[model samples]
Target: MSAANRSGADNQPGVLVTGASGFVGRYLLRRLQTEPVTVSTLQRPRHDLLQPASLTELCQGVDTVYHLAAYAHVNQAQIKTLYATNVDGTINLLSAAVAAGVRRLVYVSSILADPAFDQPRTAYGEAKQRAESLLQAAHQAGDIEVVIVRPVNVYGVGMKGNLMTLLRLLRKGVMPPLPRFTQPFSLIGVEDLCQALVLAAQCSVGDNAPIYALTDGEHYDIKSLEQAMRTALGRSQPAWATPKAVFYLGALTLEIAGRLLPINNSPGLRSYHALARNYAVDDTASQRDLGYNPRSTFYCTLPAIISAMDAGSAGADTSDTDNTQ
Candidate 1:
């Protein structure tokens, strides 16, 4: 059979993507267009997660709903906003999907929901966990086929996270000594994450599975990620690993200062906290069951991301200096 016939749902189920303007959403959209299913997107004007009426309409006749919209930032002021988007918005969308009789729902959650990181309080993770719980309840009620994808440290082109900040710093030749980085960190390329989302939407092997932790096959330490960034940028800078106590003290100072002053929230400190603890997940289940495979490594993919960012910045005749800060 042809690819179209093999994957097609015979027009009985269409696909709807939320957060269509996000980094992952962009890649997912590109991939979905190649599929035979009908595609619809929901985005807000400012936050752009689609209005309720539009969302309801899109949910109608949609077999799969990929819910990727969320307030992704982890800052003090963003806590409430995160709950509003990640929890409330998810409930709204899932409710609509239920009403529309959507066949499957793919929720993009974070590995922070693992409950391993107890201290420092991850608002994003809390909201995601709550949403997952809600979805689980719905699944129990037989409302729809729900698959929750918990991706870890997703980084690649168009990714805005701690790793991106490090890349920006590296490009500017500022290498900070990182400590408390012994934990094995997992990463998933944007493309691989998109593929997993697609597979989760289409897979019929399980019914309403609540959770899947998606990651690249291998894990890397903080030093390795930093070195990858350095290699990607073709910059050779000496970086010393500070003592964990000193690093935590500096991070605490910076965190306090950020709270008091207007500072762009740093993911570095949060990442330090994350990497200070073990976060390695076995994606073997996902690989064996859903055929989910990560395509690229941080070492291979970071350069392409940097190159694309550079090309875009150059094409627009915009200085990278302005965009980095």
Candidate 2:
């Protein structure tokens, strides 16, 4: 928790970060330190979104708010908790921000929020979508200026989620080789995402409150991505590719096991869909509007991710890890 200058000849703009302890939030905090703005972090139980009174106190004197905290678990079992935290929590936080006179809110939304995605919506995605609508409504009503950023699959050092699962399996040498899937998948490095977030905070928006999709501007297929990870991990490429049926069967077993036991975030059809589908994004608006130029590609960042995983930092309680389901 950092303090803002209450009174100064030139009042440095006050910035508050909601998910200060999450994956992207951690990188964002580091990025903000280099900027001129004074930064403040949410104090957990004291500043929880569900607790509106705490949020109101936290937002006082804050000019910009980065709303990153949310229940990101993709498991269906957590649907009730997801809505309570992601949707209702967002509503509570938005009200507090408005009441406290916060000038702008830069929301780190997910690409899943776009209804255009072909895959079935996860509980996590629906929650994010609902929260985005509330923020848009607030912006339209002139309560606060809003900039919504829908980031593609974010990857970097210490990243969790699907990629982390893949890495761990690959490290153990028990994972089968991936099939040749040509569908493109878009990914943005965490550092690049943080840069785009800061840029979003500074850029002006229209009355409609523009939404930006961010990517690393690199095209990747399942095979290429897996090969790159294997290379980074110093593993030899498998001569044979595992059939899609085997992958699906394994996922189904995990799904059943998850239901029977206490497994959260079991690999099921959703994981298969994510792995096989073309979950790409267009960042032309982001480039034109916010001057967002992503510098790191998945191929380039694999070494760092491998390094972090080797050091046993992958499954930490960061943003991606917390919502890895």
Candidate 3:
């Protein structure tokens, strides 16, 4: 393992945040600035995961790295790009961190890394899973202290992808009847995730374990999810519960349309499969290992997310909001 202490303020930990300009990265950077730590961003001209040559310079003097850079695209067509960025890039960054004598790494992995979902795993999820395996191997070899976190349905200001799409449908009074499933969907706000990450970076490292954790706190089932969100958003339209056939038909139609048209707004098969998996993570270990108490629930954070959606939709073309996160 690299020689460095996590709890020293005199020689404070030099934290490096990859994907610093991204949605969650921006929140993390903001939170880091409030602490007595040295901060650096692995962004743009000087540093990039795609450009492996840039990694050494970014890793220099950095004691802890918050790796959030990954190709988050859900489209199967981007599989090659996803593997190149998510898997290979992590290998390159891990190598760089080891060479730089970094102590610990807090990797921003996804809950979808599991292959136990209702549908065949996505290329995006597969890529993230491969990346986690690589990081875990390095930890097992004593390269660094690894804290791998799998977050479920991360939502906050400036969020996009499936959650926002569902919210939009609800706002337009076209939200399909809530599904009858009783399985819960967990979520973590950007702010809450940032706090957990800080805790991960500060916690004492030992030969105890690799520190694998998930982020989740609420228990909003699909049926109650719609009701809670509608109430929170002050929607007057009462949502109905439809059969699985209705959703399947709608998803298939949209999938077919996406292939035919130039539209890229389709949610694809993975979105349908995701809602059926009882998608919530167990946060007990996270709460015990790191002082992670996620404060935002699905119902509470909707206002910020809606405002962000409005701001994003009003100013830019569709291409600007074309994120897969």
User: lDDT: which candidate is best?
Assistant: 2
TM-scores, in order shown?
A: 0.86, 0.92, 0.85
Candidate 3 C-alpha lDDT tens digits along 192-297: 8889888888786665324444555776676676676676667864545788878877778877775566554456555666667666667897898786777777
lDDT scores of the candidates, listed in order:
0.70, 0.80, 0.71
Reference-based lDDT, residue 215, model 2? 87
Which regions of candidate 3 deviate over 4 angstroms?
A: 1-11, 206-211, 255-266, 307-325
* TM-score winner between candidates 1 and 3: 1
Best by TM-score: 2
Give candidate 1's error at residue 80 in angstroms. 2.2
Candidate number that wins on lDDT, 2 or 3: 2
lDDT of 1 by residue, 78-119 (tens): 667768877888888888899999988998887777677434
* Candidate 2, residue 127: lDDT: 74
**Error in Å for residue 164 of model 3:** 1.1
The residue pairs in collision within model 3 are 177-240
Lowest-lDDT window of 10 residues in candidate 3?
Answer: 314-323
TM-score (C-alpha, index-matched) for candidate 2: 0.92
Residues 183-254, candidate 2: write the lDDT tens digits. 887888889999999999999888898899888888778788788878888899999998888888887788
Error of 2 at 169 (Å): 1.5
